[model samples]
Target: MTASLSWQKSTYSQEQGDCVELAVIGGAVLLRESDNPAVVLRTSRANLADFLQVIRQGPAKNSPPGR
Candidate 1:
């Protein structure tokens, strides 16, 4: 169950205010916003890795300029 998983918030998050948290459960990764813990998003490790990689890469090619 999610209650047993150890959720961690990013250090980049502000000291106060809601932030996203991540947890690893078996072969899946769990994510939830601090303000709305009940609404959790679950995905595989590979998918999460790919998503993060895209975010780090910045805007995609063929997209509008300066957006």
Candidate 2:
């Protein structure tokens, strides 16, 4: 199934291993680690966008006393 999809690595990735690759198929987005190509994660574009947004925002302000 992954053979047909075009996987893309992040520009920030400098090494051959330990990098994340992404591919879009139909209405879903696919992701996998270069070192572990056999394991893949599928999610919608909207959900991926939300996850990226949260990552960009850094840690949340409201957390337990001892984080």
Top candidate by TM-score: 2
> What ranges in model 2 sit over 4 Å off?
65-67
Candidate 1: the clashing residue pairs are none
* Per-residue lDDT over 7-67 for candidate 1, one digit per residue giving the tens place of the 0 to 100 score: 9998788989789999988899999999899899999999999999999999988899987
Cα lDDT over the full model 1: 0.92
Which lDDT tens digits does candidate 2 get at residues 1-67?
A: 9988999998889875589999999999999998899999999999999999988997779876665
Query: How far out, in Å, is residue 3 in model 1?
Result: 2.3
My TM-score estimates for the predictions, one after another, are: 0.85, 0.87
Superposition TM-score, candidate 2 onto the true structure: 0.87
**What is the alpha-carbon lDDT of model 2 when measured against the actual structure?**
0.92
Clash totals for all models, in order? Answer: 0, 0
